[model samples]
Target chain A: MSNDIQDLKQPLAKANAGLDSVHVFAPATVANVVCGFDVLGFAVNEPGDEVVMRRTNKPGISISKITGDNGRLPMDPAKNTVSVSVEHYLKSVGRLDVGVDIELHKKMPIGSGLGSSSASTVAGLYAIKTLLGDDSNPAKLLPFAMKGEELACGHGHADNVAPALFGGFVLIRSYEPLDVVRLPHPKDLWCAIVFPDVDVPTREARQIIRNKINMKDAVTQWGNIAGLVSGLFMQDIDLIGRSMQDVLVEPVRSMLIPDFYEMRKMAMDLGAVSFGISGSGPSVFAFTRDEQTARLITGKLKQHLNSIKIGANTYVSTINDAGPRVIG
Target chain B: MSNDIQDLKQPLAKANAGLDSVHVFAPATVANVVCGFDVLGFAVNEPGDEVVMRRTNKPGISISKITGDNGRLPMDPAKNTVSVSVEHYLKSVGRLDVGVDIELHKKMPIGSGLGSSSASTVAGLYAIKTLLGDDSNPAKLLPFAMKGEELACGHGHADNVAPALFGGFVLIRSYEPLDVVRLPHPKDLWCAIVFPDVDVPTREARQIIRNKINMKDAVTQWGNIAGLVSGLFMQDIDLIGRSMQDVLVEPVRSMLIPDFYEMRKMAMDLGAVSFGISGSGPSVFAFTRDEQTARLITGKLKQHLNSIKIGANTYVSTINDAGPRVIG
Candidate 1:
């Protein structure tokens, strides 16, 4: 892997000889994607983070500025997910001497279960890649971003970072060697995401799950996972909706979110194909066949939250097929 | 669903007006297919069952002859899987008055984890469909075959029967409405199945498993299942091999099969991509990248069994893409 990275350095340096800085954006990702807890995710527009990088002669990476996070995120370059990822990338390419300065713009809420940390990590890594003139394939940077996720959450997971990096629908096919597969995206697919005004720490949400599960439930979950994959490939909306039932994680974790069941029922009644917690809790997502239905579901969800005396934010958008891109 | 079947009767009768008899063959199936415990299966050639059906004026199904079972199987039509399936088919089409004489040739060993009962059920249903001129989709026959499996094994399941009826690799996407999906099959894929001279009742094998599974194990199993499906679609042999790891059922069920570990190690050493118990136990199967490696593994397995003083039957064949069909 290091050798492969080295091969890209010369070409990348030549390509970016005249360039000194670059800016990139990484979209917010919905992890778990209903029936596929810990293994499936997809990207959505809005609620993303942006990062800007500039070449420096200081011989090390530094965080120059941070905004929109209200000081909730760390400013230490070594402790932050973005800078940690950049440090790893630099080490991997044997280019630690290449100094860089990074600016993080966190546009999403912290601890909202909207993959806030993953967005920063992906955007940071992407921005550094652009500044270094490393025309390396985007996927090669996944490991570095995964390392950053590990720094933030204490365990490495790619479900969020993968979609934020590759876009569309992504499956973490295996965890041992970290195999990720990008699945086909269905046209006209829309997502309705609602973030309630609540803070559910990722670690605490993960701890709520028990160590054992019913074998019957496991069989049902796996069947649905395979069915979900098949549905995506066949482009069958009804099948996709049916395959989105969660039998493993949702039943336990949804208890952390208020009115989770009632909200999901309302979404389904309003024509959403499927509804579930975005990742752990607080943030809920629904899939619909068209943008009109998506908007309707979002409107109803917002109304429901308002009637319940809860502050919430909702967004309706199609799947972000173009993961992260340079901002002009 | 019954109405849908009834609608096919008139057209089926017209199509079968001149036909008096029909014979069909259904290939043996490997259920569970490692990673997918009760929802995945595939067909293989050589070890299969044949059913012959003759239109009769008697008004009900009858089992006229049974071969290769040593009288272990029931002779009564109501008790036999094949006749049970035929009876169900006739009832579905509102053609119970159309009597048929049936013959069962069990070419594969019963209780060998080779889907012996499912093969008989599928072949019988296919034969009846042909005699009645029912050109209805083959998938429509799955429910009838699943009923036959319930009669034979005291539980209803479509994992084996689906692939036996549809051919190639199959996934039972959902159990509520019984959705089955045919997966892409790699042309170079080969399966090596070895059946030891031992009996393992499906019910007994199932009883050995606990009701609950470790949540971590379930996660790993589902991840591998997703990986397996991706591998098949991508036609990646190494990925398929890596994804064939089964952490849920095999550890518990392998205890019923003698020398399971030794045999699996030998097969892997001989270049088999993956190896595991075929369905319940006693019969073991290995996957290989090509026919040559499949043959080599089979030969080594046979020799190992002989050396251990255990009689065994081994088969080397590619996936049976053409499911049940008529043969002269």
Candidate 2:
């Protein structure tokens, strides 16, 4: 071994031994953060997924246990997001001989547009990486996790996985080579996320969107995308709010979400900087200047949804800068 | 007199008397800047238009003299881009009663897709603004110049005018309120501009483009636009070059520019960082790392165009950060 490896041998041994079993919590993400469909996303504090990884004598990855999902997820390692990601990770590091058994605790609702699968996928890969004492860069694991997403959603996109892995706001600038840029998060920025008690399958949500868009609308959307990036970099809250108008995807997709327009109007009226459908929504997210306003908007949205008999879960979160973390 | 008026009166008197006839030069601009169709542009240092504004006793705007063009431009103030912009500027400042005789000196070829009309419009308004001692923000004058573009091209777009008026790179964030953001310009960034001797009227150039674009292409374009903006702010030249791919506009509009693909290939092979049809085509521009590379690329592009019996004008310039200025 090289001197560097020799020096790290002590800590590496302790890490591998002590971390025979490790649990990681990966936060939920709001993808397609208004005006940045398929490009931008941010991590929220709650409604995430947890994955537990334990070293085993067996020579391959396996799904030992799954919870919080009520058996909705597959136990097959190849089919499950968490196990699939762990499998990919093991294969990537040429550590297939190092066996791992994964347990997924899906704390977030499935197909609710809260990036439930992405959270589990990220947490599983992160847990295995930690347990194995891997010193590789975190971003290198994105592709493995993205594979998990592809298996779950039938399409590969990194907007959710990126933020769920790196935390804060992230921009997937390009997908071919997967260039992800993590933007500086404003401390005062808060998110009001509302998940109504309705499920919109990712495939169905995507199908509603037109394959073509008017050139004029495309120009407007691109301009806003530029403005949104500028706003995030400059930390101009109002500019961000103004740029959150999604002229391309939201109009068509929002039609599938009940009371979307009403909720958006209410949120904006209550001083929410911007409001739009999150991911392939049934969940809607709004950005606010402060935590208090975020809470107020969330409470009001939930109350309105309840009064209308739609039932909802609301979350008030400042951006989670620390993405997945080890838990005792 | 009010305090502001009292303060301005002295300078106004001196400006009117000392600057009876003001000459202003506005640099030509490359609009759309690949990937950012209709919303992005940057200013170059040479091949611009010059306008002279002289105070007259007549209580209206008049086109006193026109040079460089073979009587193609209109003589009537209402019909000419420069005079129209000047008229709007005077009306905006409530100085319609203050008559002016304008002369447009077209240094760049008309309809060469080098923002020829935009330069003339900016120069004229800037001249009048200087002669009348209007110390207003330069950006506030964008609408007047944009109106000039509308009258000239049958479409009002500010991508060209904003950069020409402000100098350097510009993004029109929103059109309703006309939010133009001046992007940070890298000091070492150089442009290799080659204007082939041909006229592609802006109207004809615009007509060939489709009113709708594939959604997939739009996403790619917007993502690259974000990358380009981030690249500019971070001074990542390679990122800028990578993000300069235009899948939406170029595929359609490039059909109008003769030997466009051949010229683009030559420029790229000769160390051009990014090569594309500038503005509406006929004029092609490329970004390079330094002055030497810029000159080399320009010479090769000119030679290649000449070999095809197409005469061309080549310019090597860094981004012009100082926009419209009064010249002796």
Each model's lDDT comes to: 0.87, 0.86
Task: Estimate, for each residue in A1-328, the C-alpha lDDT of model 1 and write its tens digit.
Answer: 4555667566654664535888889999999888888999999987799998898877998998999999988889989999999999888776787888889998888888888888999998888787776776888888888899898888899999999999989998778777788888679789988998878889998998889889888899999998888778778788788889998889888988889999999899989888999988689999998888888988888888888888888888889988889894
What tens-digit string does per-residue lDDT give for candidate 2 at A1-328?
A: 1233234334444554446899899999999887888888989888789888888897988888888887899999878888887887666555677888888888888888989999999998889878888765677678888899899999889999999999998888889867888887568998889999887999999888899889999999999999988888778888888888988898888888889999999999999999998899999999999889889999999999999899888888888899999984
Pull out the clashing pairs in model 2: none
Best by TM-score: 1
Worst 10 residues of 1 chain A by lDDT: A10-19
DockQ of each: 0.73, 0.70
In candidate 1 the C-alpha lDDT for residue B274 amounts to: 90
Candidate 2 chain A TM-score vs. reference chain A: 0.93
TM-score of chain A of 1: 0.95
